[model samples]
Target: MEHAPMSDWTTLPRAFYQRHPTVVAPELLNKLLVRDDGRAGRIVEVEAYAGSEDPAAHSYRGMTARTATMFGEAGHLYVYFSYGMHWGSNAVCGEVGQGWGVLLRALAPVHGLALIRAARPAIRRDTDLASGPGRLSQAMGITKALDGADLVRNDRGVRIACDGTAPPPEPVVGPRIGISKAVEFAWRWHVPGHAHVSGRGSRSR
Candidate 1:
């Protein structure tokens, strides 16, 4: 079957991220994250972390080489290494010098299954392939090198784009999992009952 073309789909603008991270997180649920290698995923789960006030946020302690991306313009990548092993990726939001990040918790692969499978060979089921932040980053070939990459530019190899569709109704909102500080905030959001949504076992938000 021929897939419908994505002609009407537009890359999300930088102004779309001018809002707070919590506002951007849920709206990103049904959007598309496209990679340079022709792979794409429909965002299913995310967690928002506000700058300065959020104890769980990296920028809470102030900016450093590792967190400089989060303090830049909106619509940039904020990739980081976790536990000295896996990589987790986030989309930086809010104004310059003010920080906010939306952790990409999970996604449903919508295009280039072959590429995703190649990137994550151990995944037996497609739904499980990108069902966590680290897994989503690994499956999409996201690494520390993409830390400051622009996610909204039309000519960029990686971008947060649209597929001309709307989000599902009734997204589940919950506290961010796997973080030790600021544990009570209900910043995590996910598509209700999506098989691709990460489980409680995920190591990070």
Candidate 2:
């Protein structure tokens, strides 16, 4: 499917994110994550994290300095450094203080292919450029500096945009990966048979 031209891309409205993560995660498939530098990617895999009720969520215990961004208004970026090694980014969702988010697990390269390749020289194949959360962040130059950045506003130089590519009609559903707790919740959604999807999991109802 052809992506809409950059001139036709529209940043997603705040209203689009003012809902629970589960409701927003699957819908985010095929949308474009854009950077002002011209890097863009088609979202293909995601995992929803519901605060409080979700034991695996970073904000389940309450707000802390590290998790403050996760509790902020919807449509903002919530980036976190993981394992003291790499960063992962999430789209914060729901109302302020609700702490819901969708982890962007993988993206299909759509723009700035040369730049993406340059950023991830260690990756031999283009499909692996942003196949995992940590790799995705590195591929897009996202880091702690971007935590809490506003994704609804282009003022941040990064935003989620729609290029008229519709999400998958039947996304593969599975449990979230790389987490020790809440292993049974089927909150992960990915485009079926997409090569860029991060990991394998049992597809559930």
Candidate 3:
């Protein structure tokens, strides 16, 4: 599908994210994540992580310096370093202190192709530019510095915008990847048959 013009997009309101991660995850599909420099991509895959009951979540035990962003008000970015190597990005969700968020897993590049390529020089396919959480963060220049960036207020010119494309009526659902605890929660969601999806098989139930 051809990418839509940026002029047609609108930043999602804070109320859109003021819900449980499970409710916001699947609905995020097809929304555009826009950066100030003009880099943008359509969200295609995500995973919902909740507090307390969700042992895999960083805020499951309680908020620390690293997870403080995750517990902040909704409609903000929550970035974290993973495995001492790569950064992963999430959209903070639910009310303040709720400690819920949606982990962005993959995106279909929509704008700033050249920038995405430069950030992911090792990648050979366009579909691979942001096909994983680490890759997505790298492609979009997300880092711990952006952990508390506000999406609703367009802080630092980064925000999640809608481009008139509705989310999939039936998103593919499966267990989140690379997690040991709560392995059976089936919280991951993605656009079905999208080339940019990072993983396959059982994730498409």
**Predicted model with the maximum TM-score:** 2
- Give the lDDT of residue 18 in candidate 1: 80
Model 2 per-residue lDDT tens digits across residues 90-170: 999999999899999999899999999999998999999999999999999899999999999875788999988888998
What are the models' TM-scores? 0.93, 0.98, 0.97
Model 2 scores a TM of 0.98
| Cα lDDT, model 2, residue 149 | 94
CA deviation > 4 Å runs, candidate 1: 1-3, 154-156, 200-205
lDDT of 3: 0.93
Question: How much is 102 displaced in model 3, in angstroms?
Answer: 0.3
Which 10-residue window in model 2 sums to the lowest lDDT?
Answer: 196-205
Model 2, residue 161: C-alpha shift (Å): 0.6
Candidate 1 clash pair list:
none
